[model samples]
Target chain A: GDTEPHARLPTCYPYGNLNVDELVQRLAQAGLADARVDDSKEGLVITLANDDVVIQINEFATHIISANSSLREKLRDILLECLGSF
Target chain B: LIMKNNSMKILGVNEAWGELGIVSHQLRFTERIEVEHIGPVQALTSSLHTLLSQKLGTTQVQVVSEYQLSVADSVVINIQDDNDDPGKNILLSWTHQDEALGSKLLEIIKANFKK
Candidate 1:
């Protein structure tokens, strides 16, 4: 059996007015392969690259968690870029 | 981390809401203080204050805003502030690879305000 590593970077975003559908499309367009969304009690969970990068959107802010630093930075940059379009 | 004016007083401490599996710490201060290299930049603080103060369509909800800064490749600190309440804030710091650095930063922050 193998163990999985985890890391979390909690940050705020304009989530109240976030358009999830558009965000996913923009992420895909940004060359981010395997961006998936799942519903949760708090909000939506956008997982990229087999759970290597996970963005958890709550009512207040978004938490970007990933085991890899580069992956987290790439996803965050794409998300920030996409946020401007929304 | 070094500070010139280290008179900011800590008023209280409480647990804050954090994502699952992530440990968070909260501290209340009498006033906000500027720190060397560790303090948030003016633009970031302004953005956080604006986001915290904005009302969401007439709802008087408790707005929580956070700003993440990567002090190092492995150490990251997420500073959280409350809407309309600057005295009460949270400093949630963690490290991806180096836990010691993250803890040291937190300790430095705590020691500065403590003095």
Candidate 2:
């Protein structure tokens, strides 16, 4: 009873929906990070540090698509570009 | 950086060790920020600095009020850390006021560093 269980995060988006490969490529293109994309159950986490802003993107597919319509569009656009890159 | 910038919020916390002699300390959020917030956008910084000053017995200063520094929106304050040089700088954008306190880590240092 002494120890608190843990934190429950209700992320609006889930990572599984994103095209993991293209998402990694898009992040690299944006200069947000540098690393090979790895798709796992743990999901992908993006961390941004622009002087003062600290943004983290962790979500499920439906929530990500619903919460940020524009970001969803960006994801689609980036995926299309990745297709052309190959 | 803005010497008059009260766009920061802060509080103080006293840390110490237990039976294991584990010492803890920092004056972050040393003061509660109760000023009616205009919203969680950008004005929170000013309210924080105002509250922090009264509690910590320190003054809030910004670089913009004086010689311009690269960081133009950070609230600067002095704390009693006789253990360290007390010359470290903390830059907060939209983070908690206690952020600056974290800069003065004293768990391990206090053992070796003499105040």
Candidate 3:
């Protein structure tokens, strides 16, 4: 029998030692809402207009988890742009 | 926290619905670990189940993906195998409050999947 194809997985990019607090502020400035550091201080959790997105960042990389592909891409672009200025 | 050789990524949404309490982690395996008669996700999941069961001394580890698993109802892990490429990474996530359990799970994963 032929095997089924794997589902599309989200991508993770490495960014050395991001200033997550500052990044959250930048995300807010970019009009993203509810952007705050998670209680664990392990990552940032942000809520989109119609979807909930969790962006987890540590010393090595950042992870953006969302079901909406388009929204995730948009958020990724905005995040990279914010990081660019830093 | 992130691992030295393992990069983390997320793929799916929070199935828990409207609950920010649900957290996820993704990690990539450096080399492809295959099992006959199963896909990458299932193969990984099986390996995780075995490892976690042995380590945790229980057989209740839930296989979430080839690279992902859940244990003791506290953490949920997802391994990434994008576009049919053998996954080299994994994601392990949990609620904000379960930091202790999360850390233990991460350690188990790191020990087994060291790059």
Let me know the TM-score candidate 3 reaches against the reference structure.
Answer: 0.39
Q: How close is every model to the real structure, measured as TM-score? A: 0.36, 0.21, 0.39
Per-model tally of clashing residue pairs? 0, 31, 15
Best by TM-score: 3
Q: lDDT of all predictions, in order shown? A: 0.44, 0.29, 0.52
Task: Report, to 2 decimal places, the DockQ of model 1.
Answer: 0.01
Regions more than 4 Å wrong, model 2: A1-16, A34-42, A51-86, B1-115
Residue B95 error for model 3, in Å?
A: 1.5
Task: Tell me the tens digit of each residue's lDDT in model 2 across B7-111.
Answer: 533322221113223222111111111122223323333433443333333333342322111111333322221223332222222112223332221111222
Kindly list the per-residue Cα lDDT of model 1 for residues A33-85, writing each as its tens digit.
58888999988888876745667765444566554445545655655554431
| Candidate 2 lDDT over residue span A4-80, tens digit each | 22122221111123345565667568664643333345554333233121222233221111112243335434533
Question: Per-candidate DockQ versus the true complex?
Answer: 0.01, 0.01, 0.04
B1-115 per-residue lDDT for model 3 (tens digits): 3222465544334432123332333221111222222355667667778787776656447765455677766567766665545434566664323434554666667667645
Across residues A2-72, which tens digit of lDDT does each residue of candidate 3 receive?
A: 12221223333223355666767777776775665554465444444345666666554466665443555
lDDT of 2 at B23: 29
Quality class of the docking in candidate 2, CAPRI style: incorrect
